[model samples]
Target chain A: MNTCKRIRQHLELADFMAEDSFSLAIEQHLATCAECRRFQSEMLQLKHLLKTEQRVSAPADFELRLQIQIRRVRAEQRTVWLPWIPTPALSALAVVVVCTVVLSVYTSIPGPTGISQDPTAAHKPTPNSGPVQLVQPKPLKPEPAEGLSLVMAATGSTEPQNRPSPRSNRQHDLNPDKVLVLVRDQNNTENFVTVPTVIFGAQPVINTNAPRTEPADDAQHIF
Target chain B: MSIALSYGIELNLERTIPIESASDHELVAATKEGDELAFQEIVRRYRNPITNFVFRMLNDYDRAVELAQETFLRIYANSGRYEATFSFSTYIYRIATNLAISELRQRKRRQLFSIFTPWKTAPESPEDEQMLDLPDTRPLQDEDLIDRERRLALSKAIKTLPEKYRAALVLRDVEGISYENIAQILDISEGTVKSRINRARNMLREKLQAYL
Candidate 1:
């Protein structure tokens, strides 16, 4: 850097009150450069003006007031501990307050659907009357026959339709002697057991419209 | 006779310094041991300077006095934590500066609160206007009048600077604190202190060119 710039920086940055802060180099530069000299003079004047500022003193009763407050504080405080005494406690209290506020705010705002806040809510058994049942499928809707024929013919958009529903297949259950009994096997899987049509306790027709299948439970004897 | 250890305890020596002549750190050490006299000496020595410093920052006599008391009470209450690593003056000044700055911010917040909720308080005061203002109507000589006006302009210009720059400038120039102690007092680097003071001075010069 040039001497003038260097000297100006020194003038700007150095303590104006400190004698000998300026080196011979700055002095020589300032002597040669009038612009730097002017800048230095203005800065000195400004610093001097700032330094000579009129100070205002505390009121006459400041000490008396302070002493009274101090006496009261001494009387109230149980101990004269270090400055760090209250900082840790205050910070911990702040953390607890912030956490509670955040938790309450989070709970108040609506959450996404189907998710239970209490994890155990899903695990608790629901109260339902009468019998516990798995979700039941919708019943099949009847379609209109085109010509109302005695000989059964396909009806309603018959473009190689999907296989008849499990209920539809048993519509023509010709086996009056055997009935397809709905049974849960030992492994807890649903399987239809073809048992003889017998009135033990008279359940309605055993939903004979249900799909027909051979008996899978070897342990049970078919009547 | 070389004597400086008599303030806190009875030093068995040929001669000892008076309590009035004890160093600040020695006074602090004595205060730590529950010497109310030593602590009172500290308060007596610092009260005006601390009060004046806060007054310069806040430009309010009442709050400055109040906060200066708080600063001392804090020093007294926390005397055990006082370390001689930095000077007692720097520590005390730091407390006063923090209090003043916090008051300024709180005043600003209150002003904003009044602005947004005017019904909660009086009508909205201008942002730059002083709070709890007290005016002097006494007449002055021409020279004194000019000087007072200039000082007011200077104070106004100082107030206009941002908090960091204002603090560094006031501590360095008005209080005549050394840059090193200012760095400690403001919890900033010396370079940062210098930069802020430089910027603050330049800004003030721009605003107070006529007064200068």
Candidate 2:
């Protein structure tokens, strides 16, 4: 800003307070400019009148009454969280806190098994949203329902059968009710896994809890 | 927030330090530590200024004194929350200004209600009650008449100033507070304080052209 503009800025509070006085630049401006001079003089007089108006003081027993009030307030404050807050307000607050704690504790308990425990299940495609496929899947099994899926061993049975691949995804050209079993295992000597027919996107659930029985002979082809 | 547990076990601060010489922050700290002497010192220091400040805002001595006492009680009640960031004077002034503003708004609401309902008996104002208590019987001299008119005109001019500008102008010009402190007390920018003060003073100058 230019000199005059800046000088007027300082003129706002100058001489308004007892110790505040005009700067040399403002003094020079006021000395030369009649408008600035008149403004300052009038403000000075107005401030004088404002200061001269009688000041009000507290009553003789202001402190005494304040002390009693303080005690009363302190007594009320001791009865609750705040002086003006009623019990219902606190009751509402308590109810909210209790609900939050109970909900948090309930949500924190690990869920029941068989209800997708994998954290990455959130990122996977849901069965209804997209097609689910098995590794080396066979042609459509038209006999089954829409959600029921079938898996077959890719190689001979001695080799571990690639189960319905979670990462395997393909669009099958069959009816919605019939999901295809893509591969066939020719050799019967296998650690045969029982794949439960379930919804197409459903992960292959092997009941690891069931005791394993040794195959008594090579002819025992377990499904 | 209430200073919950400090009211019990009155402690004396006379031996710790001279209460008069203690700084405002130190007194607040002492008050937080349950010292009544420090709080009394604070009251002694601010009672008159706060009463006058609220009086200027409300223009009613009785209500001003009552609100001033309420302001102190609040300060004592909330002393635990007092931070060293702002000067104790600014904090107390903020509280006093808020209390005065609330009282003004309540009075405005009462006036509006009275205007709307003619059947309801009107309540006596502080001014009417004051006039009833002290009848104006004595004749005034010429000098007193002129001075009284000037003072009345000044108070009227200030009261007529908008709510936003009144505190800034009073704190700056009449109370002699610094611009920065006034900004803090009013919770406004320093630029806003300057503009408000300028507007308030210009309005006053126009209203009191004869006196000027």
Q: Which candidate's TM-score is highest?
A: 2
Runs off by more than 4 Å, candidate 1:
A1-7, A17-38, A78-223, B1-17, B114-141
lDDT of each: 0.66, 0.67
lDDT by residue (tens digit), candidate 1, A1-223: 4767767667777766453567887777778888877677767767877877888887888778878998888766646445435788978988999999999988876453212334223223444211111112233333243211111111222122233343454243233333343443333344444444344444323332344354354213432
- Judging by DockQ against the true structure, name the best candidate: 2
Worst window of 10 by summed lDDT in candidate 1 chain A: A147-156
Q: Each predicted complex: what DockQ?
A: 0.52, 0.57
Q: What DockQ number belongs to candidate 1?
A: 0.52
Candidate 1 lDDT, B1-212, residue by residue in tens? 43244443456334456778888998898788777778878888998889888887887788888999999989988888887788989989999889989999998798687677645554345533543343344445698876777677677777767888888888988998989999999999999999898888878776766665
C-alpha displacement of B60 in model 2, angstroms?
Answer: 0.7
Q: Indicate the residue-level lDDT of B186 in model 1.
A: 95
lDDT of candidate 1 at residue A37, scale 0 to 100: 74
